[model samples]
Target: MKITDDMIDYISELARLRLKDEEKESARNEMEKIINYMDTLNQLDTTGIEAMSHAFPMKNVFRKDEVRPSADRDDILLNAPDKKNGAFKVPKTFE
Candidate 1:
């Protein structure tokens, strides 16, 4: 697709960018080159290639989740500077 001055102006407005006359021309030329390169890529053949989410193979590396005994609640509450109703009390953050 060809990048026109009007298209550049529209994009600049959407991006909330204020470009000088020279910068607008430069952006238009850069956008045209990018689109031309994309068009060239569209000519490639990939009939039997499998689509991948990433360029490299990936695998989950998580440890097994196992149930374990937890520390006593009273033992934990003993260390708190402030406690209320068996829970740690914190200052109100919002109204």
Candidate 2:
């Protein structure tokens, strides 16, 4: 696809970019090159190849969950410098 100056102007406006006269020409050239590369890729034959989100295979690595006893609240709070009503007291994060 041909990248025109009008196309560049429309794209810059949508992107909230302020391109100078010289920069507009540079952008047009770079955008044309990118489009040409994508067009070239469209010519490749891969009828049976499966599409993938990533280049490598992916799988969850989590271990099996198991029930376990938890630490006592009193024993866990022994190291806290300040606490309130059986809970750690921290500085207010929001007004």
Model 2 CA lDDT for position 12: 92
Candidate 1, poorest ten consecutive residues by summed lDDT: 37-46
Candidate 1: segments with Cα more than 4 A from true spot:
45-95
Which regions of candidate 2 are displaced past 4 Å? 47-50, 56-95
Error of 1 at 72 (Å): 31
Best by lDDT: 2
Clashing pairs in 2: none
lDDT for predicted candidate 2 compared with the true structure: 0.93
Q: After superposition, how far is residue 56 of candidate 2 from its true place, in Å?
A: 4.6
Residue-wise C-alpha lDDT for candidate 2, range 1-95, written one tens digit per residue: 89999999999999999899999999999999998888987789989998998788888689769988799999999999999999999999899
Every model's TM-score: 0.45, 0.47
lDDT of each residue in 21-62, candidate 1, tens digit only: 999989999999988888986788989989999888898789
Compared with the true structure, all predictions reach lDDT values of 0.92, 0.93
